[model samples]
Target: MTPAPPKNFHTSNPETETAIDRTIPDFPAAQLSDEDKYFTHHKPPSYLPDLEDEVKEFIEYHQRNTHKRIVLVTSGGTTVPLENNTVRFIDNFSAGTRGATSAEYFLENGYAVIFLHREFSLLPYSRHYSHTTNCFLDYMTEVNNKVEINPQFADEMLIVLRKYKQAKESNSLLSIPFTTVNQYLYTLKSVSQIMEIVEKKAIFFLAAAVSDFFLPQSRMPTHKIQSQESGGKLEVNLEPVPKFLSRLVDNWAPSALIVSFKLETDNSILIKKAKNALDRYQHQLVIGNLLQTRKKEVVFVTPSGENSWIKLTDDQISKEVEIESLIIPRVIEIHTQWIENK
Candidate 1:
């Protein structure tokens, strides 16, 4: 028998700013939202079908180029919504500082990034990245991939890539941003698709705090704390958190070098859980952390059962030095070794 969904499942609300209660609503929808509505092709999340054609052209265009590899990294936490058309919700305390900061490190180390960002995160979108395209084939190739990720992120990346391709101007690569969990999933799927055809071994940072649970439907009525009847009778039904990893590892990125994270309520149980994460997903690595902590001290667990811990004491060491300095390089180094072994 399946477990019931939580009462509180707050999803991303792009607008409608209000104080976050981290509380779930008290009602249940008999029917869930039609997942097909969100997708370009009527599926949950969405897919960019044009990305493959672009990657193929890009590979041929850069057949003799000296580029080592193209890396796609996703960072930031996901929000939990009480219902689909999210008004009141629950979300992680994460500000997306770690993921965004780490993205900068990846860019500095010379990896082209599909840096998926959430709103109000550390990294702001960079226009400089849009000015680096050198040719039609080159621009079209990468733009094609960028465009398919999600219109929100693709728009920015495409603008930068297109401008550079047409003007033959050199510019920095961009950090493609998205607003909500749905957008993140769509973009992640697109990047995974691009990496496969290009023969690129991607370094995915499942740093985003994806809500483990989702509400039954979006159009459910706004839950009222003060009910019309107070006689101790309420019926609320729920669904489980969407299984992102099952689809990502098993189907989308079967051979990619994947890194996952596990957040535990108990620190003592973490090591065991980290090891379990590695075994469960067959990922290259698994990072574990305790829930609700100021310091994001994490344990990096390898598939062979090796584990490493990084404690920052505080996320920001100096004015300019942030947590990403400690994290991104480790990811790059691990990714480097993983590719070499293959």
Candidate 2:
């Protein structure tokens, strides 16, 4: 059976913008499912078929004639809706910094990437400037009826633009978007199953901050929930999301090099929880990080006991060197070794 929900669930109204309660209720014995029924009953993201078709074409192209490796990089945070119409929802605090940055490094290392990310989240190449305080518009100016990059930002923009164009022209990056958790899971399964052709050469970088609990569609009200109707207090019962990592490791893409991230606020339990996940899922690697220090440091846990830490120096961080710059190369090295041993 799946575990209980995490302790961070809350209820809020849009107008007041204040959380009334953060107490998550435990599931009644009757509400629990023996197996993960999340994918079974929830209506899929409507865009699943289109995303699958795009990925199918992308994977087919990569499988032929070229020795290029393929990777599925999942990024950003998935939403847990409170209602069928989704007036309110629970969200994670991920901007997809790791996944987006890592995808860029993978592309730099000659890997074709399938970037499956939260809708409107950060992306490779464009990610540098897209979600930052100084966005694309801030770096551009209108010059003689044509929009041109400002002279101050031109040099860096040129490098980014060239890399983006090169990836596009080479057909090296295929981006698919998702908003809700159901969409993420369904699309992940489809993409992983489709990637069976590449076998061990395929890498699954599961970096998305998936929600731990969600109100099932069956239980969610069909319309927007009214605060007045509910006696001015809102209570929600969220079910534990199924452990799909087990399915991904044991069934979905068994031969693939799978690496997952474990984020916790507490320092004491971070490594322990990550090691536990490695033991449970039997995946290739689990990257454990504390919420406060994730960008500066992460520990890699493996079943073979090759546990190690990766950290960025203050100097490196000041130089604008993203940790992912260090991370992806190490992961590539590990993947190479895995393939060789296999």
Candidate 3:
């Protein structure tokens, strides 16, 4: 279940409480067209080559053999470093539950999954037992120098273990990890380009809580900023991240079906903002969710200008059925239609 909305959460009109966070710097006014400058400022992640290799191998093998649909699921929260060394940073609020769970459903529906998630966040299959309240050790007990699952949790653990093992044996899941927004952007571009080989069969489900503000390399200090500066008060200036969704749609993977997420605190403008994004990015779908009610409800806005909702029933919640179990099948139906139209 999703958490309750924060006490400060409001339902003011758009004019009063805009969905966008103003503290995050707006898109560059002077150099709005300089996409290359953004990439040059934040260097690529160190693991780019290895990540690309894995994605390439996965895509090639699937396209050659099964030729089944492929979905790229980006999850978790991305961080924005304040300094080059990165002692302090800003973080987005996400545990990656939506993305990770969705990946398992995609795989179960016969699609190979490429899961790109924030480091140390929840993972598919293992998420049920790896959360903060529970750990792997909690479900295991060692006796006679042999480790066995605790009897109480054994039934559920065995089921998850079997699914995880099956995915591993079939080589249907490829996991790539990232921590910062810089790494996420580079990895996303690389993955999109690689997945282009699948043509219309590729789907991009971008559920990551990406940061809106970042300290540019040019403005960031080489070392950590000390607390003594300015009487123990620090002032930070950040720049808005470059818009790359358009590039993903028009250049990197033109034929792919892209579904971007729009997370908002206010329900009033949730569908409004989601529709705006579909118009702006020309993507296939936008999944609109509220910060507090995300796991229980979501609004789907498509290019056809229809706004539909998926809500979890009280019975479903009581039965321990996840909302993703409903979201993924609807998405698969949309993807099937997309392929047929192509």
1-342: candidate 2 lDDT, tens digit per residue: 112221111213333222221221232334543223354345545566667679878878877745689999999999988888878989998999889999999999999999999989999998878887775688889999999889998998899989999999889999998888887887887788778678889999999999988788779888888889768898989999888898777766778999999999999898889989998989989999888988889998988887799999889989977888888999999999989988
Candidate that beats the other on lDDT, 1 or 2, i.e. the better one? 2
lDDT assessment of candidate 1: 0.55
Instruction: Give the TM-score of each candidate.
Output: 0.62, 0.88, 0.89
lDDT of 3 by residue, 245-325 (tens): 987888678898999999999989999899999999999999999999998999899988888999999999889889999
Tens-digit lDDT string for candidate 1 (29-96) = 33222321232221223223343344434433333353535555555666645545556565665666
Please report how far candidate 3 places residue 24 from its true position, in Å. 29
RMSD of candidate 1 to true structure, Å: 14.0
Q: Give the alpha-carbon lDDT of every model.
A: 0.55, 0.82, 0.84
Best by lDDT: 3
Clashes of each: 20, 0, 0
Where model 1 places Cα greater than 4 Å from the true spot, the runs are 1-68, 83-85, 124-172, 218-237, 291-296, 312-321
Among these predictions, the greatest TM-score belongs to 3
* Ten-residue region with minimum lDDT total, candidate 2: 1-10
